[model samples]
Target: MKRLILLLVSLPLLSSCSDQWGWYVVDPTTKTGLTNLKFLLSGLEQTVLMSFTAIAISMVVGLAVALPGMSSSKGWRRFNRVYVEVVRAVPILVLILWVYYGLPQLMGISIGVFGAGVLALALSDSAFQAEIFRAGIQSVNRGQYEAARTLSLNYVDTMRFVILPQAIKRILPALGNQFVYMLKMSSLVSVIGMQELTRKANELVVTEYRPLEIYTILVLEYLVLILAVSGVFRWFESRMQSDER
Candidate 1:
């Protein structure tokens, strides 16, 4: 991964001598470029914060929704299906726009750009998270539930103590994938003026007139962020596996 990143970074430098390519705009060695880099990096905090907040909310919401889908009652199962279908049907961008713009008008309550972005992202992702959780919960062996019943564990207690922990472990990879997806999707919030990584890159492109160079850096930023997140998930998975043994 380090070698790949080095190669990608060096590819542009190899062509730096060409007059057609203006690498000076993002050149770390220069004062202007270094300042621009810092400005771009400044948005990382908002991006990470927003994505984490949204994913956290989504996980809870998803678990709640997933429990209903697992219920034997047809009404509850229908409700779960309807919710997942409706939420997933909407494009995330449209949902973001509506939450930021339309929702405020309808509710007669103001929501800031960050709040709206998080809400929209959480709502949109919760649908998929529900499915992931449902699958994970259902994947547990039937004997686990029988054992819980024998121990006099009620539905809630069974889920809380016996089922959810195992389900969460099984779904950790999916959850991590969702988080990475959240990070990427958070970039869309830039359109609503959240000033995240892509927003910062877009602003810089307007100022520097170097779309290729600026966006290249943006790609690297996301690449590094997602790679780091994936590494953490892998570490957690290893730890969990060791604990199981």
Candidate 2:
């Protein structure tokens, strides 16, 4: 709060300098680039779409990978270790470039801006989500497995009926946090012309030539988005807590 107050107080001084040659000012809703909010809205929608698709795909992939990774077999465990390490080690920018540019050449097929963006982010997020699932599943008590065994439940039945329910509760918060991270990372998709919020902001900056104010607006927009996500997470947290009681 203090930082926000200081930032708001300083905006006038920072934006009032004589050297603000590249800065341009226009009516917030009447500027050439921002003449219609439709463009911004379209961009924001694309961003949300990309994040949603990516997160959904990542959740599925993470669960699939995590099951094998968490297996007792040495080979599966080793493969999981390498998979997580390699993916997490690579930078998101590099992953984006590979998916957007390299993928078409490799497969002789093209995924458009939206497809490529979702694929890239999902691939990256899967690594993290796999770890989340692994940790969640492992956190279940040994006694839970023993109880399921006493009921003559097989591994699959045990996981579906006994393990996953508890694991899901523990991992809900982490998944929500991952969704927030994925939302911000979707901005990187702009590099391949996905036209998400950041990309629209760039176009606005170029046309209106107001980097400072435009970027500030963009930051505030993202802050709102993050806060909304956090609010939803809090609601889920409350519900989960109530269930636990």
Candidate 3:
């Protein structure tokens, strides 16, 4: 226990050496060299925007797919299963490229880099979210459905009021995890020149000729973002547990 505690305590000190902020000789408020900072910060914002937007779309698509996949109808379930399989099998980066570049020529409608990035992320994330919801829905007791029917609830009403509420409670943690995954995956958007955080880091490296510092800063920003998300999820999980109690 003593050795473990010592090692644990030393971990932060070790990490701080790598991320130690250097002296700031440039004017803090000036926009000269700060152009790099501006672009970097904007990239961070773009990452956040992409993730949140994709997650929003994912929620809708995932739930739509989940509902059909969970239905009693054999045809609908099969259809949804095929969709999930196709999406899950395809690589997301390939999908992003196809959407951004290939689809324009084929469909005669061009999507912007950010739009294609969001679409690709949403398509990928929705498959995962669909499975999450499916598992949550299946975990509900059959007796709950029987009870709701006895109370004169229609199928839709029963799902809306009883099944979904309970399923959502059970799945909240998984849902939060998927959101964090989405946030990290948004960094991939830089491939299509969406000017997200990773792209901004690349731009900074080109201008400042400081690959080490720029990449380090990029990593720190993502670490902070992930930590913030984890903290929020922890708080939300605690509140959910309290509500359950």
Candidate 4:
């Protein structure tokens, strides 16, 4: 809060000096500047929506993939290793390009901009999430499984009632980090024209011809978003730990 207050206080001083620096285009008090600011902020909706949807899908896919890594069957375990290695190898920008273009061409099915964005982001992040879950599950006390067995609990019941809750808490911080990663990576979808924050800035730059000022806000938008998200995650993590204690 103090930092934010300091930043807000410093803005006018920076803007006032813009005249000497010849950067008057971002004078937020001016009509043109205010309009540009609003236009950029409007794009935040698309950015947030795309990120949230992608992370939700990633969590589901990641857990499914992570489970096999813990299986007794060698085939399932090998498949898990192969999946994590192969998927994590792909760069997000390349994945976004492939999903938006090559996927439709090969499958004879097309997803729109938003769908492609979510699909690409989720697929790319799921590999990391899988690893996080795998480690989290493995970190659980082996005695947990023995206790479940002593109770005559089936494997499914064991995971559902005794394992997942603990694993989720252990892995949540990593998951939260993945979400922030997904949020930033969503910008790559701008290349395919999702009209999210980056795309919005790109378009505004073309017309407004003020890349410096426009991009500064663009940076701040993401910075504020990431900070707010990290803070929430930390608070949530602390609360969960408190509950456990």
- Tell me each candidate's TM-score: 0.96, 0.88, 0.86, 0.94
Cα RMSD of predicted structure 2: 3.0
Report the number of the highest-lDDT candidate.
1
Q: By summed lDDT, which 10 consecutive residues of candidate 3 come out lowest? A: 19-28
Considering lDDT, which of the candidate structures 3 and 4 is the better prediction for this target?
A: 4
Once fitted onto the true fold, the runs of candidate 2 whose alpha carbons sit more than 4 angstroms away are 1-38
* Candidate 1 global Cα RMSD: 1.3
Each model's C-alpha lDDT?
0.93, 0.84, 0.82, 0.89
> Model 2 residue 169 lDDT?
90
The TM-score that candidate 1 achieves is: 0.96
Residues 1-245, model 1: lDDT tens digits: 97867878686877666766777888889999999999889999999999999999999999999999989999999999999999999999999999999999999998999999999999999999999999999999999999999999999999999998898898999989988998999999999999899999999999889998889889889988999999999999988887672
Total clashing pairs for each candidate: 0, 0, 0, 0
Using TM-score as the measure, which candidate wins? 1
lDDT of 3 at 159: 88
Lowest summed lDDT window (length 10), candidate 1 = 11-20
lDDT of 3: 0.82
Model 3 spans > 4 angstroms off: 1-33
State the displacement of the C-alpha of residue 30, model 1, in Å, after optimal TM-score superposition: 1.6
Clashing pairs in 3: none
Error of 1 at 196 (Å): 0.5
Task: Report the number of backbone clashes for model 3.
Answer: 0
What is the lDDT for 200 in model 4?
92
